[model samples]
Target: MSLPVLLLVILALAAIAYVTGRGRAFRTASGDIRQLHSLPAYYGWNAALSVLLPALVVLLLWISIQPVVINNSVSALISEESVAESSLDLVLSDVRRVADGLDMAVETGALSAADARSLTSTGTDVRALLGSVGVALGSDVSEETLDAAQRYRGMSSYGAILRSVLVLAVGIGGFVIGFRASHKDFRARNTVERVVLGILIAAASIAILTTLGIALSLIFNTVEFFKVYPAADFFFGLTWSPSFGGGSELGIVPLIWATLYISLIALAVAVPVGLFAAIYLSEYAGSAVRAVAKPLLEVLAGIPTIVYGLFALLTVGPLLVDIFGQGGLLGLGWMKGGTAVMTAGLVMGIMLIPFVSSLSDDIINAVPQAMRDGSLGLGATHSETVKQVILPAALPGIVGAILLAASRAIGETMIVVLGAGAAARLSLNPFEAMTTVTAKIVSQLTGDADFASPEALVAFALGMTLFIITLGLNVFALYIVRKYREQYD
Candidate 1:
């Protein structure tokens, strides 16, 4: 049976268990709910959870293990000599795909089940037959591969059958146990609450474990990268030119410099405009104006960064080049093309404006009105009151908002890729093309570079560096917020 169908069956069984358990609980309490220690719904939940959780666990475990088992068993059948230099993974993937296609053909009545089971049937080109039935194999299947695929199909079918039986049996048994345990003296509410708490803890642990896993993976790969390429050159060397061939310079300084320069320009354009916009909306605008204007401004946030990159590439970059390029007004000859640092920085700044304004508006509004009132009552003008009282009160949060936006700008890939040119260069002129660490990471991992090679592994080091920089920015922002933020009792 399909996974979704099995899940639906499990849910149906759980529903039945819930109804039966609730009914049994009422009978045990002699149809008087007050006689029971907990509500009928609690008893129902206890039974429902008992049936669902174990069955779901079994299903998940089976789904995860079945693929690994099948892959190992089928891969063992394909001899290393037969595979030549091709990846075992790729061969196994082809085997699985062909097997799945054969199964589909059998299901759709294009190929009989008996014919699918026996590949040695007279005059039958299995690959051609499969292709006629819409299963396109990359090449003619060898005899050994065809045999392995057949074994894979048989094992998968048996495994599915066994899995369905085990899941259903566990669900029924759990329902029986839970229903029998449902009585007047049973603490159904406490049991159900504990189950819920366990689920919540599991969810929280998944997030933490996922982050730790990512960090460990990055660290392992970075260590490997340094083993092949000197750490000093990777971190401190000024050039970044990676060739799959040996003796290539693998410095990250140029990428880091461009990343920081673009981020600084973005912050310079974003901070003042977003902060001022927040001040206008929060402290000065009327209710109707605030409602209309705030949402309209925040609409920029919903637009994807790719769209902004297009805006930069198609509209802003060309306009700037026309204004600043040779034979233009002022004729500076500074910008030669549409892709440059200024183009990306300006669009990124525009993209970050909504983030800053939204967060800063909330922070500004969070400042106590009494502080504003007291400052104004002391004969301070509205501007002075906002500048002296409200802004000061919200300064830490505003700083946090700016740093968060900065981190985003630093990590952004699509805008930098499409707006700023991909050449990793360190230059003082904003009109010159540049690239960031994220873009380099993408470029390094792509193409025909071997995974074990320094060229490919450098991507991990670049990723780890970007991760650390963003992490440090976040930590600093939190420290500033905690150290200077005022408490309102």
Candidate 2:
């Protein structure tokens, strides 16, 4: 059976188990629910959980393990000489693709089951036949590859049959156990609650575990990079030039400066405008005005950064150059090109405006109305109340909103790539074309360099640095929130 069909059967079995267990509970208690330890629904849920969880777990494990076993077994049959023409992994990938193509041809009725089993690459146009069925093979299939692919399909078919039988048997066993245990005094509710708590804990730990995995990977690669390239030069060198060949500077200082410079410029534009808009929406705007205006302002955040990058590249870049470049509008000749730090910063700031505005608006609204009333009652003007009382109460949350916006600005890639030129340097001039750490990370990894070399490994180091910077920002934001938060209750 197919995986989906098998899954549906398991669910049907669990449902039947639920109904049976509930009926058995009622019969055991002599139709007197008062005599039961728990409710009828609890008994039903306990049986459902007992049968469903084990079956799903087994199904997941079988699906994951079957592929590894089949791949190893099939790959072992592929001759070393056949793989010498190409990489073993690449040849194996082609083998799997050929297997899939044959399956599709059979499913579409293009090939008879008997002919498919007897077919060989020696006489047949395997690639052409596969292309006809819309499963294009990447390379011509050799006899060895064809043999391996057939084995792969056979093993997979056998595994699927075995998986279906085993899953159903385990599910039935669990159902029998649960159904027999549904007695009048069984703590069905407690058992169900414990299982649910375990599921919840697993769900919660997913993010923490994923983050740990990422951190470890980055740390390992960063260590590999530092072993070949001096850590001091990477951290403190003034230049940023990475050559696939030796003698690459691979300095991060200039890139770090550019990142901070652009981020600061972006925040300078975003924080004030977004905060003012938030204050007006929360304090001054009418109900209808607030409702319409807030969503409209937030629509800026929904725009893709690529569109913003295009705007920076085609629209804003030329506009700035027209005004600021060599003797044009204001007779100023400071700017040379359109792509510069200022261009990306302006576009990034516009994109981040809604993030700051929406969050700050929510934070400001969360401040108790009594603070505003008390300030006004003390003969302070509405403006004074907002400036003094409301703003102070909402400072922690507003700081959080601003810091989050900063994070967004710092990590942005597309806008920096298209708007900021690919030059990494330290310059006081905002008009100078420069790149950030994220842009350089992309450039370094995509370059023609060996993955084992320091050049490509440096991407991991850059990633680690960026992580540390963002982590510091978050830690500071948390400290600010905890230290200043008002306990209104």
Candidate 3:
């Protein structure tokens, strides 16, 4: 059976187990649920989980192990000549691809089983045959490769059959054990709760481990990059040119400079406007106006960044060029073209405004009404109370909101790619084209460069740099909030 069909069959078995277990519990209780140790539903669920969980575990283990075993067995058929011509991994991939393609051809009736078994690279154009079934090959099929592919297909077919049998056997055994365990005295609810808790803990551990795995991957690759290219050059050097050939300048200084410059301009636009809107909505605006205005302001947040980037590229960038470019509205000639640092920064700042305003509005509203009333009772004006009492109390949260917006601005990619040009340089002019670390990371990993080369590996170093900068922002924002929170309370 196919994998999905096998899972559906297992689920059907579990459903039968559920009914059998529930009936067994009902019979054991003498048709009185009050006499049972747990609820009737718990007994059914306990049995169903038993049939589902063990079968899934076995199915997963079998699926993961089957390919490795088959690959190893077929690897022996690959000749040393093929390995010398191309890497072993690449040759093995071609073998697997050919095997899969043949399987597809047979299943789709493009090639019959008898014809597929008798086919050879000498007598048949194997690439053309596979291509007829929608599998494209990059090169001509070799004799050893075709043989290895045949072996691979045979082993995989047998392995899949064995897997189905073992998984079904395990599922049946689980059903029997769980059905027998369902008795009037059995603690079915406790058992079900323990299983659920175990699942939740496993899920939590998987998330944390996934994050740790990402950190470790970046660290290992960044270490490899630094070992090849000098760490000093990668960190403090002035340029950011990476060539596929040797003797590339892999400095990060210019990228970091542009990143900070764009982020600063974004924050300058987002912070004041967002904070003021938040103040008005929270403190001064009528309820109807606040309802209409807040959601309208927040609507900007729902628009995807790519859409915003398109606006930057098609609309905002051109507008800026008309205003600031040579022989235009002002005749200043400061801007040369549509793509520039100012264009990206302005668009990014516009995107960040909703993030800042929504967070600040919520934080400002969270300040106690008693605080505002107390200042007013002391003959203070409404504006004076907001400035002296409410603002101080909510300053920490506002700072957090601003820093969160800053983090998003710093990490933005599409707006930078579409609005600012891709020239990685350190310059004082905001109108000049520049690039950020995130954009460079994308450029470096793409194209025909070898994966092991420093040029490609530098993307990891760039990613790690962005990770550190964002992490530092979070830590600093947290510190500021905690420090001032204690003082205010």
**lDDT string, candidate 3, 220-274, tens digits:** 9999988888998889999988878788998999999999999999999999989
Please report, as a residue range, the 10-residue window in candidate 1 with the lowest summed lDDT: 480-489
**Which residue ranges in model 3 land beyond 4 Å of their true spot?**
284-299, 379-381, 478-489
Global lDDT of each candidate = 0.90, 0.90, 0.90
Candidate maximizing TM-score = 1
Could you list the CA RMSD of all candidates, in the order they appear? Answer: 1.8, 2.3, 2.5
Enumerate residue pairs that collide in model 1.
none
Positional deviation of residue 109's Cα in model 2 after best superposition, in angstroms: 2.2
TM-scores for the candidates: 0.95, 0.93, 0.92
Supply candidate 2's per-residue lDDT for 342: 93
lDDT of 3 at 411: 93
Q: Please give the lDDT score for candidate 3.
A: 0.90
Tens-digit per-residue lDDT, 338-455, candidate 2: 9999999999999999989998898888888888888999999999999889998998888988898888888999999999999989999999999999998898889557789998
After superposition of all CA atoms, the RMSD between model 1 and the true structure is: 1.8
